[model samples]
Target: MTTRKDYTRPLDIKHGRVDMGHGAGGRAAAQLIEEVFVKAFDNPYLRQGNDGAALAIPAGHRLVMATDAHVVSPLFFPGGDVGCLSVHGTINDVAMCGARPLYLTASFILEEGFPLAELKRIVDSMAAAAREAGVPVVTGDTKVVEKGKGDGVFISTTGLGVVPQGVDVGGANARPGDVILLSGTIGDHGVAVLSKRESLEFETTIASDTAALHTLVAAMLEAAPGGVRVLRDPTRGGLATTLNEIARQSGVGMLLDEAAIPVLPQVDAACELLGLDPLYVANEGKLVAVCAPEATEVVLAAMRAHPRGAAAVRIGSVTEDPHHFVQMATRFGGRRVVDWLSGEQLPRIC
Candidate 1:
């Protein structure tokens, strides 16, 4: 290697495409990182260009980490693309445990021949999301594969946070008499992706609710201060599947008020036309909070104050039942079992 004479030109982001050399961990890879990811995600740790980031977390707090892989098709959706989802998903997972996300790392798998412009757009979006969330992408890796062997792009993000002392929230923490509160409407993310994937025409615009919730979670924690029993975001299987998972984990039963659940009229109609149940659809920006009945008002108020949780409402309550089942009341004056999602209703709808 030349110490001073050798030089590499900037990447042709304007009209270039990804290729096998970029993943070879060589000059091309270094140049790509310098021109794209590092420039977009400008930070001291990333600028160091080390193999990994070295973070010094504060003492007296337990660390929480979460990793998520995003392989949703249509790479770009109505309201969001895979970029924001990768950030929001990881941040939300850590926030569910009552942690404040502090940092993140990302990895990308790029298919050969993929347009560099699209990749730049995604990386720029991801950088913006990280900045908005007050977290930085400290380190990341990139790999390019053969053209036909991979899709456009796949992103895996790892988030790191610290849990404040005495703040414990998890799926198994739910108890009988705890009230369940839904942050907002359901099935928006799934339907938004579906609309683009299938080209289903809808009169109204339906956008994915994908967003980072760490700030909202911080506000909620400030209000409850440990009153919350279980906190979860209904992502893949929507509200029904997430509730069922929590029920089984806590070995408790739930009684959901169907009429209380919020759903956008257009999303409801879309589900009806597709023979899909909104309960099993997915949401990216919403959350399900289980808190003591006494703290419901406080937590709801905190959520409603946030722009994302504008539709916060009490949907149901935890109950004492040996069955560990999730049952729902119907608008037709009947009850139905909100069962576990048997199969994938919308795969790759992240």
Candidate 2:
């Protein structure tokens, strides 16, 4: 339990830096959580001042939970920071299950000497993201590590939601006759983050495509219930790796039309200069949907109607192949295997 002892002085949020005392589980810790976290993520369950949140799930729905860690470098990126990324990443994970996200729990590992202003900025971003997504951060844990022993700050978040009955979405649900749909252009997030790095340079700026996707998902389910068989957000390894995973899991293969897969011209140019395959790049706000052939047009239409998926297109179709290979028909009329990323292409990219 936290002891709310009256303090005579307020924390200097402007010029103050975090110290070991903030995570000591005493007055300093209490004050930090009360003034900062509580102020931003003010909600009934969180204001209860409990170690865990008490939540109620919708009746007749199955529970869904997903967690993710945010350690992207630069902390702040063109379109998002580690804060919103932490919230969006976990929320997307839960939403991918065809669930309605309800609550979130956050855990922070703060490096001693990290600036209080930066911390507050991140927390505020997280709070805003939760509010916009209609989810609340009801509980969380905070810890401090010795300087140089940890990054400025690392965040891990878990989201909980309820999936209505009759909805089934997963990697293993993909079938040989399924049609593949991509949410939008690829490589935007990866290129945006990489452009911020000291080693890379770009003439034209690209922003990360980070956004909450649950609403778009809801629209699809509402439009064609039981039509979507598999849904995945191509994050770390981008389109190729994610598709390969789905193919292997479903004991099937995939054939992609390179010309149909959308890629922004600037992003394509940047990848060409860097010798990076856009297919293997990372994307934060995009998703891939595999639906039954009969429902492809309906689902595609639904996706295009949503703001997050306005660029949705049919990229390929699942096929029967014992090897479970993901091959793409190139614009040059030749086909090649779209294999898993051979090694780390970009590091510290979430």
Candidate 3:
């Protein structure tokens, strides 16, 4: 005979709608938690009903915190959705400071009348991503907006990390002659999301490279201690905007070899068809590293060894030009100025 525990049919997750009861502090909310959040993100800390989580910190390391909000249109996209992107985006932000991400706090703004099934899918994805990255969402808040006032859902994540002593990395640290390295192909994330948005079918599907890159950064730092000058993830404004920010912050110039930059042919073709500049496209799973020239090879080797950076390449170098300009040498043997993006090309991309 099936006991009540065994007969609890998972809260009707398939066809149920998210009514106001889901956000109410009542049995309905508890049922949602028990069936969805608890099931997806099982952990000792979360199981405790305290208002906050208790964690132990390691000695000699300073904690780093970073937060990001995700309001990307079309919650579901190729290779990732808003759920996984939320986790990776904040994790990457914390890791860009050369820290080891430890914990995450998430907030959800949900729309009433949304499908419980979809919400569960997104939450499951977020839980899976956090688990895979070895981070836990220790605390979270959920609020429901009237049906039309909000998108399907919006997620904001705050990440906590530990930065080791004597390791410094920032946009202001790029020095002249530092080699610039790209983790892998550019424009993949942006194009992937764009394709899904426009329903633009392609011969070969392009998937977003949405991933947490802290481990890759750790490996690179270990291989070339003190040689890593700066690190930045090219997300919103893409490589051009990110490089320009670094150049202006460090008061240096950059010269990128266009041929050395990697872009999938489908992405390039899509960009051409859409009149979009790949330089200004967005990326979720790539990093731009500015390292000492002597350490470039070692850093590249280290990056290639990581699953997140298997296609790492040396793409450019910092220069001493006074204008803090970023220029690219095209494959046609001509150079063109790569300036900061004038306006948002693809807004709400992250």
Candidate 2 — worst ten consecutive residues by lDDT sum?
A: 1-10
lDDT of candidate 1? 0.92
* Per-residue lDDT over 191-293 for candidate 3, one digit per residue giving the tens place of the 0 to 100 score: 9999899899998999999999989989988998788989999999999999999999999999999999999999999999888999999999999999999
Better of 1 and 2 by lDDT: 1
Lowest-sum lDDT 10-residue window in model 1: 1-10
**Full-model lDDT, candidate 2:** 0.91
Better of 1 and 3 by TM-score: 1
* Candidate 2 clashes between residue pairs 3 or more apart in a chain or in different chains: none
RMSD of each: 2.7, 2.7, 4.1
User: After TM-score superposition, what is the CA distance of residue 165 in candidate 2 from its true location, in Å?
Assistant: 2.0
Per-residue lDDT of model 2, residues 1-350, tens digit only: 54453443677789888888788887888888988899999999998898898888778789999999888988888898999989889899998999889999999999999999999999999999999999999999999998998999899999998897779998999988899999999999999888887556677788899999999999888877799999999999889999999999999999999999999999999899888899999998999999999999999999999999999999999999999999999999999999998789999897
Error of 3 at 76 (Å): 1.0
Which is the winner by lDDT between candidate 1 and candidate 3?
Answer: 1
Q: What lDDT would each prediction earn against the true structure?
A: 0.92, 0.91, 0.90
Model 2 Cα RMSD, Å?
Answer: 2.7
Question: Which predicted model would earn the best lDDT?
Answer: 1
